[model samples]
Target: MANNPCIIIADDHPLFRSALCGTLQRELNEPQLIEAADFNSLQTAVEAHKTANLILLDLHMPGAEGFSALVFLTAHYAHIPVMVVSAMEEPDIIRRAMDHGACGFLPKSASIEDMTAALTAALAGNLWLPAGIDDTPAANEAELNIAESLARLTPQQFRVAAMVNQGLLNKQIAYELNVTEATIKAHMTEIFRKLGVHSRTQAVLAMAQLAINPNSTLEAFRSQALPLQ
Candidate 1:
């Protein structure tokens, strides 16, 4: 069906890529598919095929991480929605991708029905997060008060908070920030207290929303915000 929508599939694994393409072809019937085996291939494909309606991306490619790719596409081509198709079940990664503007995510073990449903939901303009992952960016209360809370953090803490907001686990944050996991955990606890949040999801939602509208001054926020010890 030449009239059907077009999608680009970017995955490193041949078997999964082939299987996913086969399933999509069978189910979608008419949607055109462009396959990319790696990040370079995906970059090239994205440049050449600007008409793609959606992108199905794998997270752990060797050269370029899936998150970066998501950022690139969403920033450069804001009109095209990107969905993550990955095996990673980590809550933080899932949450991070959503914050970075992924339209949805499907685990590698997802059933055929689930995959089709997620894709359909995304195409319909819905954010495709898993059942319990809570893709609702507006559902968290902390997110509603981001501007006030970010001011409570010190410059270093702000850096840590940014990584945390990006969905990095404690260990990953530690590695990225050149600190121990324990340090990251401590910073997170302090962040939660300052932000009046209890969980990672809450912190993420709040921070992501703050990034969207960063009008408040960090110093002005510090003067009025309650101290968190």
Candidate 2:
């Protein structure tokens, strides 16, 4: 890590973030810390600090879906490492997070020692997972394909697709992203092409394949839009 390595703590809960921040400060000797209370801020932080050394993410941020943000971060910022520090510490969620691309998973309840160790390991280009979690039943071929397809999207396209997955219309997406509807429409077209989907609904369905819902391979299946074949 650099002498003043930058780390982004991307979690929404204020108290938990504070506690984690304190632990990192104590353990890391106050490395440059950036706090983001939501996913949009996370994006802004990453964009502003492209040379960041590590990102500690929470899966349930305001604008993020479980595992989806991890996928986006890992995809868009392949040079920087991401470690999940989430309250959803079940083995299944942890395993899914790893499958989607996070280099480490530290449950919120983990000891400060373990948390600091996780952050350090990820910065060192290593994988650090929770102890005693069985690593089995890895992500399936379809899920892998879905993740790869999503990795094809640019950072801006990923943001547009995330909003579309939330069921937002183009104009509303434009308003939120503060771009013209025509600009958003052009982005949607590229998103659809890269995702191999034909329409907004299909684009959402394609990105939803990377979400936390294990059951809604149904939507992807029905839409037949993923082009993972």
TM-score of each: 0.58, 0.87
Deviation in Å, model 1, residue 58 alpha carbon: 0.6
For residues 63-107, write the lDDT of model 2, one tens digit per residue: 765577888888889888889887777787788888887888888
lDDT of 1 by residue, 1-229 (tens): 3347789999888888889888988878588889898655776787888878889988765434235456556766678899988888767667767866789888988888888888887777777777788754432344434544665675456556666655577898788768898988899889889877888766654554433222342343345553532
Question: Model 1 — TM-score against the truth?
Answer: 0.58
Candidate 2 clashing pairs, residues 3+ apart or interchain: none
- Please name the candidate that would achieve the greatest lDDT relative to the true structure: 2
Worst 10 residues of 1 by lDDT: 210-219
Judge candidate 2 at residue 188 and give its lDDT. Answer: 85
Top candidate (TM-score): 2
Clashes of each: 1, 0
Q: In model 2, which range of ten residues has the least summed lDDT? A: 220-229
Model-by-model lDDT, in order? 0.70, 0.80
